[model samples]
Target: MIKNMKWLLLVSLTFVACNNDDSDTPAEVPVVAGSAVFTKYIALGDSFAAGYSDGALFAKGQSNSYANILSQQFAAAGGGAFTTPLMLDNIGGFSSGGLQVPKFPTRLTFIGATSSPANVPGVSATPITTHLTGTFSNLGVPGAKSFHLIAPGYGNLAGVFATPATANPYFARFASSATTSVLADAVAQTPTFFSLFIGGNDVLGYATNGGVPTSQDPVLGDDITPTATFNFAYNTLVTTLTANGAKGVVANLPYITTLPHFTTVPYNPLTAKSIGKNNDAVGLATIKLLNAQLYGPLKQALTALGAGDRINLLSETSTSPLLIKDETLPNLGAQLAAIFAPTLGAQTAGAYGAIFGQARQAKTTDLILLTTKDAIGTAPTAANSGLGIAPAFPLNAFGISFPLQDKHVLIPTEIAEIKTATDAYNVIIAAAAEAKGLAFVDTRSVLAQLSNGGFRFGNFTMTSSYAVGGAFSLDGVHPSARGYGLIANIFIDAINAKYGSTLRHVDLALYPIQYPLTIQ
Candidate 1:
């Protein structure tokens, strides 16, 4: 089934590429009025449409946004003025309680063959009070989901501090009213053309949070948006936007797990050499001694069950498989505590059980998030030194004693759930585009290309690799300026085919592959 699915996707992508090819050039081509209207273009979606990069929404990133690039091309083909809710400065941030609060770090800079964080302070000079007013064309909110477009009070400033989930700071800075809906605000402009690239955040939140739901309610907060709810909301959005006879383009969701944020780190990062030992025997022996003390008689049982192989003996190694939460493991802790109760006393045995009970070695299928890189070899704080599991031996102090928290790793089961949700959402988006007769952009195929081989645009090549990929910025999830420029050309191909317009594609080489850490 998987092989067949891959073949079908490949064929679909080939069809799209062939359609986009303008090889049979028209000499002295006559101007043609396309079937669709392009007098006013309004883009509506999340961070990608907003041109958010390096983990922040700043002026330079917004200027190079895909929507802005598309609008510029549209102008030559009879489109009108395009505007965005621009940030005050290149150093992106927001304000809280009338004081500047830096939301994201500055853009990354390449220094001497390495990508490092620029020496910029966290605080931004611009406050959220510096608002840009007027019915703007770009309606892309950075963290918006599919349902958020129809949700009222999503832009309420009062809800910013009181109820963050109910309010969006980006929209609050420019929403027409406290109770205004994102969809309603976009519709009020009566746009002649629009582009919708939502649904990424619907499943992205689950992946980014290491597949843990924020609340008990799976449909709310940082869980996957229910498929039924997504269908209803998506259908309504397309229906309302096209009710006035405006033509547009809609992009499908890509697999968020494939991005560098989740793929950069490998699963089996530990080895004998990494532990500063000459042989695997030395490392294995050291880990066995620690395990015997930590688990007692349960140590043999764990080895028999292959748990010993997963435990990294290396101490303070930068690259190591993160010890993670494994609730599926047998109640070895309880059994061990009972076995050692007579000699060690109940309290001491129980302490040992609490420390090693729920912990296990992360598997190859599991993914340790990029954020875990900093905390991997670091020492645990006083509050987290539970029972001093490795008090005698400091080498086992890092991950063996201090297990990586649930938020740092995506277990195999969580990965399966994310894949399921992403597939279901893509189906809904494709069906909606077909029903509305709107041009559909298969972003999944594009992302697959970026992940596997690498996408070539004009004279440059880009991939989903971290830092040096040239496609993604420091944040890993969002695109760099050059990446957005390539995306603009993809949209142009779909638009020209659907509307029968000869819209010229943008020159991607004009955009910079990497933005300097500071404004130069």
Candidate 2:
């Protein structure tokens, strides 16, 4: 009986070993057959995907984005040419060390223009001018919102680069007001593979507004992409792409506040010391509270201020008062002075305006704030200075930026809020990508790392410091072409890893910055 029991135990062990061996046997996992399944690639998204920046949409920036770069690799592997909204012309090249970039039109502000609207050319038209030849593959649109992709006949809509009514001579030669947009065109194309990068511009408009509570000011209009809307549009877009038998990649939004434009101009809280009032003058806090109303949650706080606090709020934007020009803030500081003066008396108001002007003119400690830091540079004094106002930095010169305008202090709360919103947006992006089986590229972290020092990309060092051969543009918000390339690589690596594609990596050495050769 003992002998039979030992034999039974040995047989049971042998059976278990055999089962383990079978489980360990290599299974025939299917490889993605025919790279051509991904051959007919279509790209859809906003400016980052389109590589729009530096005030002009151009081929160089457009071609360098990861989508285009990936498409190039796909084509080399027998894919098709990527179709994009290539800028028609007047794209200014990079500045030294890539620190200063000339805005579109070189001189005109987004707010200020001449009596006659300047003619600006548009992207290519269909057939002869457009991408209908079936040779085209990329479909990137600048200023495109997530839902805009599906909007009826959006491509043919005017006011993108030019308006048809203006008979805008500039666009007459190049505008394709009749051409189909990325959404309609890509859907019509029926690509086997696609890339979707939309919804960035949605939140961007609000962040640019300084994070004011849209709930209180309906006129302010909610600038962020409503979460529900984003979900609906994004789901529909993805469903359509997948249902069409196309496999594609999607990217999340980049942090808005990280750009050089936002970072370079900081508002220092301490400089509030330079501004104060006595029994004769209104308190500086009133000026501050009022100015803060134009942005952020401070408007609620301003409403609570007493009439005795009637002194004009010194704006952190211009270091003067908030002014409205026909309901819109004008490009000039004089406009703010005119509208914001307390009804003390004509003399007092004039005196206030003069003092406001002095603050506007003050370089040592007068603070200026704007709906955008971009406006700060255009302040009359800095415009006349020949040398633009230096961006404010933290006193420690470490990474933390303390907002300042010509040494004057500005509030830190709104800026901090902007950064917080950016972080939150990026987090949403990351979570969404993970849930949807997509790759999330943390551009904020990547940029911060580079700016804090620099990052290594295939032996190349990419820094974020302005014009220091770093990756940022002059506005400090947008990246240099090289910077964009770095961005492309970040997305590319993520896509490659998630999808198992061995696409060629970006060649950073080929792209060079044009501004501040050294940070010091």
Candidate 3:
């Protein structure tokens, strides 16, 4: 009770910084539009533009998206109304195609000091089957890649039921036509000024899935779009948007590998408290047992195979890194089986060799994905069941007794792959912005700064830390409402710098660090 109370107090203190000035009277500030016109503003991009936070997009999240915030500021400088395809309720996610899982799940909420954000506890009311009328100024669709913007039938309702499900559920709800593309719908609006912050989802999908290969994306739209594919798609969209003399601001993609989704879960999380769940004695005993039965034999076998440094003895007083499967590592299973077969039977020995052959303790360069944190100490039966992978002695603790699978962690090689792709993507974005003469917002460097240390907003500094950090929501991927406000200011800064406009910055302090347990 005391801990929850303290966290609640801290939450209040962290979000709302006291200015000490209670005066109601406000000072009038002068503003100017300079050379840019804001009469029909349109926002086009992915989830960030639509204001997705806490793992889902809800009513309040859309209201506070950077696009909407920027639109409101644009309104002050002669911009028109910025309408959004608002969801039906505060709880996000929606029922689509009668899928059992309801397509997307409900939005996440923080209740005091929980280990992770919990669902808001209800079914999402927005149904993809039901269509929303009206031409909205905000044409941002979640889960959209660069190529998806120009791909026709991206909004087709029938595509949602196709074998691969070609259409996006978010777009299927509000698309102007069954065959209209996201860019086509935006082009129809004919905006005088616009904002495009896309191409992150191209890399985001693969990065979030722990560098899953582009070919096998179990999660649809989770594959990394090829560099050439992204280059052509981005250029095409920019060219079409600017073809009609529409001036806009374009934000570049960030290195998503540094986001909280990839960084929050430390490589070494096996501490005394975590291992035993607040019991030091039991944890020490378990550690001893694991060392004697697992580590000792495994280390001996690996060292004999010229890989002694792969496994290390656990220290009772220190933290231990989890054993993870690195696909890039050379398989030593056959060699390991021969060595372990002396004491253990051939079948059991072979199982151990097969599981740990390419496995090693996670290093600093390796990233333990945020979603994989909870599955650390649990048994891996449900996933690996019937695969003939389990050892004979019930040594099935994930990341402890058994190595975590490829989906659970991103090794150095995978990290390099994502970074390389992001670097190439950024070059294309910068080149497009220059060639088109559009205002450019370097979101890559901005997010990098946020990850390295923290981003300063007045007296408070917001880090990208999960759950508690003001910059990111519980999901660890999308930014919080306050983070979106900071992003809005970033766009305004670029717009002002490029076009000599004097757009007013939104008050970052006014935005909440995160939505409360219930938005309604």
RMSD of every candidate to native, in Å, equals 9.5, 13.1, 10.3
- The clash numbers for all candidates, in the given order, read 0, 39, 0
Tens-place lDDT digits, model 1, residues 179-234: 99889998999989999999888888788887877841212367888899888888
Off by over 4 Å in 3: 1-29, 96-100, 214-219, 385-394
Expressed as tens digits, the lDDT of each residue in 1-520 for candidate 2 is 9999999999999889878856677764443323335667777776566665444445555666657777766654556666654543333222223232322232111223432112122222221123222324555655556666655445432432343221211121122334444455666778877777776666655555444335311112335656666666677677776676666666666555555544544343222332332221333453354345422222222233321122233444333332211111112224334545544355444433332232221122222332233333223333322224322211111111111132122224444544554555555555656655655566657766875668776777887654454586444445677877777677667666777765555688887564221111
lDDT: which candidate is best? 3
TM-score of every model?
Answer: 0.84, 0.57, 0.92
lDDT of each: 0.75, 0.48, 0.85
TM-score ranking, high to low: 3, 1, 2
Tell me how far the alpha carbon of residue 432 in candidate 3 is from the true structure, in angstroms, after superposition. Answer: 0.8
**Candidate 1 regions off by >4 Å?**
1-33, 97-99, 102-119, 216-220, 271-299, 304-320, 339-345, 382-400
lDDT of 3 at 506: 87
Give candidate 2 misplaced runs (Cα > 4 Å): 1-36, 76-78, 88-135, 158-181, 209-222, 266-436, 458-460, 515-520
